[model samples]
Target: MDFSIILMIIGIVCVVVSFFLKDSSKKIEKDLEELSISIYQETNSLKRRLKVVEEELLLEPNFQVKSPLPNKTKSSINQSFQLKQTEAAPAKNVKPINEILVRQVIELKKQGYTLQEMIKMSPLSEEQIRYILTNNGGIQ
Candidate 1:
């Protein structure tokens, strides 16, 4: 009445399945020996084939490793003593106003100056200072 009969039936079924599983596995051990021999022969043959291919490849000329200088004529390259001058781009010495202002603020702040003192040293007005400091998330 307490499901003990059902549990015992399930246990017997599991035991029967385990016995069948064990009996079935005895056949595979014989087959595994044959499988092992076949696997060994396959591996040995593959190794021999790979060795022959490697030896053949070693005999051939490796074209990729050749020096490219022999193909290019020496006269085609610049031989004249004229110094190779890189065209100088006239540099724009301009920096963003806000960046310069931020750098000045950080530098002045690092030097133990208050935010107002840094603002005073900067060329920007009170309004510009407020905006940059606020954007940069400085004091207020």
Candidate 2:
């Protein structure tokens, strides 16, 4: 009796599985057919458009469209002209490097002068002096 009951349960599960698979397969087949039809329609439309373009090209062999340049404002044009003129002219107010001060800084550091003392005597910025000393193996 127990064996008969087990067999009956297995039969019911198999029936349920078969029903699910059968419905899914039909739905899949229907979707694939619709997709193929859509693809065919798009391909036909593209072919028609390409043929039209080819015909237009054949009718007018030298047909060309020129793209217009971007419009420039008056102020922008004036600014660009001024920029070119300024670039052509020599730059004024350029800072001159003080070679004497650089030499003095190196000399002071060689004499074991502390960074604070060097900053007090030199015209260089603290960061500039620190960079010089560190790069020249004068200080950590």
Best-performing candidate as measured by TM-score: 2
TM-scores for all candidates: the values are 0.27, 0.38
lDDT of 2 by residue, 1-140 (tens): 99999999999999988877758777999999999999999999999999999787555523443323122322343344345446656574222223334456778998999999999998766855665565433421
Please provide, for model 1 over 1-140, each residue's C-alpha lDDT reduced to its tens digit, 9 standing for 90 to 100: 65999999999999988876756556788789899999999999999999998776454422223323332321212111111111222343222233334445656665788667866798765544554445444431
Per-candidate Cα RMSD to the true structure, in Å, reads 23.4, 22.9
Ten residues in sequence with the least summed lDDT for candidate 2: 66-75
Clashing pairs in 2: none
Q: For residue 113, what is the lDDT in candidate 1? A: 82
What candidate 2 gets wrong by more than 4 Å, as runs, is 16-22, 61-64, 67-140
Global Cα lDDT for candidate 2: 0.62
**Cα-based lDDT for every prediction:** 0.53, 0.62
Residue 112, candidate 1: alpha-carbon lDDT: 84
